[model samples]
Structures are given as C-alpha cells and as structure tokens.
Target: MTSILIADDHGIVREGLKRLLEAESDFEVCAEAADGREVLEQVERTHPDVVVLDVTMPRLGGLETLEHLRAAHPDVKVVLLSVHGEPPVVQSAAALGVHGYVLKNGCATEVVSAVRAVTEGGSYFSPSVARQLVEQLRAPRAEIPDPLGALSGREREVLKLIAEGLSAKEIGQQLSISAKTVEAHRTSLMRKLGVRKATELVRVAVRYGVIEV
Candidate 1:
C-alpha cells in the first residue's frame, strides 16, 4: 500500500481528495493537513510515501514547505497541486526536484496518476501543465527578446508593486512618486509586456517569477 498525505488550505478540498485517494485499493491517506505548517508536522510523524501538496497554503506555502520536506525527508515523493498552473511555480518546483505537479481542476483527472507515477519514482505533469511548460520554455527563448528584461529599474519596480496587488495610489505612496507617474509606468510596462490588462500582467508576472500566485 502507498501511504500518502493530503495538504490543502481548504477543508472541503482536502476531505474530497482524501476520499478519492482512499477509494483506491492500493492508496491510503495516512495524514492530512490544512496548511503548510501542519503538513510539515504531520509528515514528520507519519513518514508517508507521497505528499499531495497545495501551492497557496498559509505560512510556508507549498513550494517552501516542499523545500523543507525535501531536505528533511528525501525518501518521500512530492506532488504539487494548485488552482493555477503558474509557470514560475511549475518551473521552480521542477528545479527543486518535485516528482509531479497537478492543477486543482486536473485533480480528478491527474492527481491519482501523478501520485502513482511519483510513488513509482517517475515524473508526472498533467497535459495542460506540460503545454504550459513548453510555452514558458519557448516564450522566453523564442525569436523575440523578453520585453520585461528591457524594463528600466523604475518600470520594473512599478510592475512588481502592481503584481503585489497594490493600488496605483498605494504603490505611489510606497515609492514616494505621484500616482500619475505610477499610472504612466503601468501603461508603459503593459505595452512593453504585450499584455492588455492587469490580469494579464499578473499572468506575465507569475511566468517571470516576479510574483507568486
């Protein structure tokens, strides 16, 4: 049997995943945690074979929690799950030696497969995630240069604050700049980034590792 741990901030989500995992004859949920801190605590105690982790948890969050777990329990497999397949998170988790990654919507389709694959010492990434990774790898390496890299220091600062979810006024106050100036920088950054709106900016920010989703 494969001993597993389910870690997600939402109680309902965790319970749902637990039920699904438990339904499999060879899989069992040995532990469950509502957040990253609890995940660490439970894993140390249970020593589960696989960890199904959520990326947006409170405290340490999934990536950082996985970092700790990898150092402390190298034998355990890690499968990162999230609602959004942010490129930076996916790429960073890949670099950190994660066994697999699955999006929340893909949970029904990919979670079990990811768990089984990772437990068997193989890598698993959902089809959508695979497509996103390919896009990310190609986006920065494509015929065109990364426009964000062309940003001036002040423009980059503006984008960071925007990605942090700060209002124009708030960012201006933080940087001791006029709100109009902040807006102008936002416009410039969006144009350079080829993103039409704030939401797309956040998407780009996530891709570039400028912000966590």
Candidate 2:
C-alpha cells in the first residue's frame, strides 16, 4: 500500500482528498495535517510514502516545508498542490526537487496520478503546469538577479516577520532577540533588498513567496 499524508490548511479540502484517495485500494491515507509544521510532525510520526502538500499554510509555507523535507526526509515523495500555475512558483518548486506539481483546480484524477507516478520514482505535472514549464523552456531566457539568494537565513526570517506585520519588538520577542537587534536586521534587509521602506520590503517578500498575499 502507498501510505500518504495530506497537508492542507482547509479541512474540507483535506477531507475531499482523503476520500478520493481512499477509494483506491492501493492508496492509504495515513495522516493529515492542517499546516506545514503539522505536516512535518506527521511525516516524522507516520513516515508516509507520499505527501500531498498545499502551497499556502499557517506557520510554514509549502515551499519552505518542501525544503526542510528534502534535507530531512529525502526518501519521501512530495506532490505539491497549489492554486498557482505561475512560472516562478512552478519553477521554484521544481528547483526544490518536488516530485510533482498539481494545480488545485485540475481534475481529481490528476492528483491520484501524480501521487502514483512520484511513488514509482517518476514525476508528474498538471497539464497546465506542464505547458507553462514547457513554454518557459522554449522562450528566450534572460539573466535575472535572484534577490532571494542575496538574503541570509536570519534576514529571510526577519523579512517574513515583517511581511506578517509584526513590529520590531514583537519580532524580537518571537525570535528571542533584542528589539534593537531586530531593527539592525531590518536595516540590513532593506539594504540587501535595495528597498528604502518597510512597504517595499514586504512587497519583495510577497513576490518571492516569503509570505502569502
């Protein structure tokens, strides 16, 4: 049996996916998580063969969760389910070693097929996602600076908190750092991102998927 974990913030979505997968004799719904942190916890406990993870979640987003999973649970296959079919989002998931990219609006069968293919050491993409990727490849590529790469880990964390609308003191308390230090990091973040204001910083973070809209 292919034990699977379904991770999505919406309980209804999770329920629907579970019911759909349970209809197949070879698939078992071993676990379900409402957020990225819960997803990691469930993965550790259940050791599911495959995970159907949504893109946006509380605590941690799907892309960040995928990165952590890659480092810690390399054997587990991941099929990313998202509402987004944008090139940057799809390309980022692909770069993170996602086994499949299935748009949420695609037919339910596509999700099942993605899980099966990934479990079998192959890969899958929703038709629309595949077409976008293909078009991206066929188009003329331009060299673009990756602002995300310029950010350090702590800087990214600060950026996320800022995007979440936390004040410097609140961010410091959450991170166990002094408020002054938080301010320093904020300054550095602005400098690194080439933004002069907090609003611009938030915009960059959102654009790069550091925080959801």
Candidate 3:
C-alpha cells in the first residue's frame, strides 16, 4: 500500500481530498495536516510515502516545506497542488525537485495520477502547468518575473494573510509571531512593493499570484 499524507489549510478541502484518495484501494491516508508546520510534524510522525501538499497554507508555505522535506526526507515524493498555475510558481517547484504539479481546478483523477506517478519514480504535471513550463523553457531566462521573490518567506506568508483580510493579530496568531512582528512584515511588504495602502497590497498580492482572487 502507498501511504499518503494530505495537507491543506481548509479542513473541508482536506476531508474532501482524504475521501477521494482513500477511495483508491492501494492508497492509505496516513495523516492530515492543516498547515505546513503541521505537515512537517505529521511527516515526521507518520512517514508517508507521498505528500499531497497545498501551495498556500499558513505558517510555512508548500515551497518552504518542500525545501525542508528534500533536505530531511529525500526519499519521500511530493505532489504540489495550487489554484495558481503561474510560471514562476511552477518553475520554483520544479527547481526544488517536486515530483508532480497538479492545479486545484483540475479533475480529481489528476491528483490520484500524480500520487501514483511520483511513487513509481516518474513525474506528472497538469496540462496547464505543463504548458507553462514549456513556455518558461522556451522563453528567455529573465522573461518571467516573480514579484514575491524579493520578500522573505515569512513576509510572503504575512502578505498572503493580509490579502485574505486577516488582521495583524490574526496573522500573528496563525504564524505564532507577535502582532508587532506581523505589522513589521506588513510595513516591509508595502515598502518593498512600493505600495502606500493595504488595498494596494491586496491588488499587488492578487496580481503577483501571492494569493488567489
């Protein structure tokens, strides 16, 4: 049997994914995590063969967790799921050695195929993601720009939460940081992005694929 760990911030999404994957006879969901931090913890405890990770979780995002997973558990496979199929995001996951990339809007069967493909020492990419990757490879190396590249991972997390309309205190609670720190990240994000208002921040976040609309 293939042990799987599903991670997503939304409990409903997690449950849905769990039920979908568990329907497969050979797949067993060993654990579930609400955020990237919990993902890491569950990974250590459950030692799943494959992890179905959502890209936009709170605290440590999927990319950050992928880095840690590659360092600590290179043998495990990862299939990244995201609503955004931006080139930079797909490229970043590719660079980090993700085994599969499945868009959230894709058919549920794609997720199962992704897990199976990765476990068999192969890779899979949703058709849209594959097209973006091909475009990326054919274009100039500097053709695509990632605005979120400038911000630290923590700052990106803060920006995402802010764009989601969470207060500084709420962001702090989720990240386990102080409200002051969240404010500091907000200020930094605004300054770095050359925006003067929170609304501008939201616009920038949406435009740059930091958060989905």
Candidate 4:
C-alpha cells in the first residue's frame, strides 16, 4: 500500500480526503493532522510515504513544517495544497523541495496524481501554478519581496479587501471588526509595504494578488 498522512486545519476537509484516499486500493492513509505541530507528531509515528499538507494552518505554516520534515525524514515525500496561487509562496515551497503542489480546488484525481508523482521521485506543480512558474522562469528573477511579513493575518485580510476595492465600512462589516480596526490594518500595510500613497499601496497589493484590485 502507498502509505499516506493527510494534514489540514479543517476536520471536515481532512475527513473527506481520508475517505477519498481510502477508496483507492493502492493507497493507505496512516494518519491525519490538524496543525503543523501535529503534522510532525504524525510523521514521527506513522512514517507515511506521502504527506498531503495544506498551506495555511495555525502556528507553523505548511511550508515551514515541510522544511522541518525534510530535515528529519528525508525519505518521505510531500504534496502541498493551497487556495492561493500567490507566486512567492509557491516559489518558497518549491525551494523547500515539496514533491507536488495541488490546489484544493482541483479534483481528487489530481491529488492522487500528485501523490503518485512524488512517490515516483518526480515533482508536481498544479497546472495554474506551474504555468506561473514557467513565466517567472522566463522573466528576470528579482530578490524575494517579503512585503507582507509585518502584517498580521487580520491586517492581510483587510489589505486584501481594500485591494479588492471594498470600502472601509464594508470591510469592517465583513470582518466583524470596527471601522477603526480596518483603518489600522491599512496603516499597518502602508508601513510594511512602504507605500506613501493610497494609490501606491493598492497598486502594490493588487500586483501581489493580495487583494482583487
């Protein structure tokens, strides 16, 4: 059997994925984890051949967790999943030696293919993200811009809404935070992104796909 460990923050998602994998006669799911730390624990215990990890989770992020796994268990393979097709995050995961990148929106078949690819010692990148990587490879590479580092998750959320052209009141309503908090996020993004003007900030956020604008 192709031993597997599935990792995600959502119980429903993990349960669904587990059932899907179990249906495949060639695959065997050995463990499940709901966070990065639990991922490490599962890996240590199960030593599964493949790890399917979600990108976003509380505490240590998926990519960071993968790095830790590579250090301690180089024999195991990993396939990363994400909703965001952001270039920087994808690139960083690739550099960390993830065997595959599968978007959660993809069909279950794609997930299986990703796992098989990694198991066979080949890497996989989801179609959309792979295309982006190809374009970037053709272009001149620049120093990685960690412009979003200082911004908290809440701040990032606000910046994305702002970039999507949502008014502060609308964003505040959506996030359940006050309008004052929304403004504070904008100010934090401005400082972290080093933008002097609202237009400039929006432009930067849009370019990064942090917001829809």
Which ranges in model 3 have alpha carbons more than 4 Å from their true place?
Answer: 166-184, 191-198
Q: How do the residues 42-133 of candidate 3 rate in per-residue lDDT, one tens digit apiece?
A: 99999999999998877778888887898899999999999978776787788888999999898999999999999999999999999888
Worst 10 residues of 3 by lDDT: 144-153
Q: lDDT by residue for model 4 over 12-87, one digit each (tens)?
A: 9999888888888999999999988799998999899999998765444676678888889999999998786887
Tens digits of lDDT, candidate 1, 1-213 = 999999988889889899888888999999999877799899989999999998766544576677788888999999988876755557667666788888877649588899999888898998888887677777755553445446655675677668778899998897789999999998999888888887788777667655456
Winner by lDDT? 3
Q: What's the lDDT for all of these models?
A: 0.80, 0.86, 0.87, 0.79
Clashes of 2: 0
Worst 10 residues of 1 by lDDT: 140-149
Tens-digit lDDT track of model 2 for 15-110: 999999999999999999998889999999999999999986766678778888998999999999998776666777877889999988889999
Pick by TM-score: 1 or 3, better one: 3
Give model 1's TM-score versus the native structure: 0.66
Best by TM-score: 2
Candidates sorted on lDDT, descending: 3, 2, 1, 4
lDDT at 133, model 3: 81
What's model 2's overall lDDT? 0.86
The 10-residue segment with the lowest total lDDT in model 2: 143-152
